[model samples]
Target: MTLSAEYEKLEASINKSISEHNPRLDSFLFNGGTLLALAVTIAATVPWPDNVSWLPRVLAGLGAFLIGAERALNFGERWRYHRRLRDAYQSILDRFTLAVEASGVQRDELLAKITADLDQIRRSQGDIPNGTPLQG
Candidate 1:
């Protein structure tokens, strides 16, 4: 990848990481409130056995279902979006910027690292010569 592509990737990763992870607090609020409301509604409508307090179980199930659904959907969407973003960024670098010499690994290796796992990029302080998938 060229320097320009690297820059674009860096910028994009920063933007997306911010967008996805930053909303955790807000998403939590929304998810929690929604599940709580659903649980309450279920409890009100569906009466359980006389011996069982079904409301708690209902709340747990509802909360897990909602949160899991949200996470799963977000993962699917974000995965596609990031793939396109990375490809575009790399193309831009190939066309416009000078070739950036990667010191650590082959381009294919780095690209594989990037496409599969990239959490390591978060802690890198200097220019990452190779986009290797980092183990946390």
Candidate 2:
């Protein structure tokens, strides 16, 4: 395939990766945050029952569960990680386009170097599979 065509394919792949991860990140953070907040609200506001003492225990358990889920999932960190990766891929895309447009270098050589750079960026960022579905 032509260099431009190859570039376009790579660009599309990066965009698809970004799009998939973004929603997953958002869902993780939002749900985790919401659950944690609800847990806190319940823990703070719910009145203790005199007879059914199990209620407080249940609430505490719920609160612990939410907090544990948040920590275990590490949603906020994952979101940040994905955001950084997306931005990095964008920077690569921008640089590649500009370089290809401006350089008088041989097309094959330029494409090889850029492909190497892209691989390096992916490696440095993390080896997490692109577009991998996040599990709750």
Candidate 3:
């Protein structure tokens, strides 16, 4: 394949990776926020039976659990990692494009840098939820 073609393929892969990480990140943040808000609202406004006094406590506990679970997933950290990787990839792409334009593109060096950056980013990622793909 031509140098430009290979570069484009790498660009697409990076973009896909960014896209995949972004949604999962947004879902975690949004769900966590919504769950907490709902819990707070229920705790403050919902009047429960005096006999089953544990209801409010249960709700509170559930809320805390949900929040903790979200944190445990480490979505926030993963999101940041993805963003950083995306940016790094973009920078590499820009430089690659410029080098190609200047007729000085070094395919091996470009591929090596991309692979190294990706490896570094993946290594730097915090523990993420199991069963989720590390890259998109």
TM-score of each: 0.26, 0.65, 0.58
Report backbone clashes per prediction. 0, 0, 0
Which residue pairs in candidate 3 have backbone atoms (N, alpha carbon, C) closer than 3 angstroms, thus clashing?
A: none
**Model 1: clashing residue pairs?**
none
Evaluate residue 59 in candidate 1 and report its C-alpha lDDT on the 0 to 100 scale.
Answer: 66
Instruction: Point to the candidate with the largest TM-score.
Output: 2
Model 1: residues >4 Å from true position, as ranges? 1-52, 55-75, 98-136
Tens-place lDDT digits, model 2, residues 1-136: 9668877898898777656556475566657676776876577567776886677777677777767766776666666667767777777777778766765566556667777877876665444433355353
lDDT at position 43, candidate 3: 88
Number of the candidate with higher TM-score, 2 or 3: 2
Where is the poorest 10-residue window by lDDT in model 2? Answer: 127-136
Expressed as tens digits, the lDDT of each residue in 1-136 for candidate 1 is: 8656666776675556545434344445555656665766566566677777776676667767765655645533444444444454444334322323454456556555554434443443222222244565
Model 3 global lDDT (CA atoms, 0 to 1) = 0.64
Error of 3 at 6 (Å): 2.5
TM-score of 3: 0.58
List RMSD in Å for every model shown.
12.4, 5.2, 4.9
Poorly placed runs, candidate 3 (over 4 Å): 23-27, 30-52, 105-136
lDDT of each: 0.51, 0.68, 0.64
Work out how many backbone clashes candidate 2 has: 0
> Which runs in model 2 stand beyond 4 Å of their true positions?
23-27, 34-46, 49-53, 105-113, 124-136
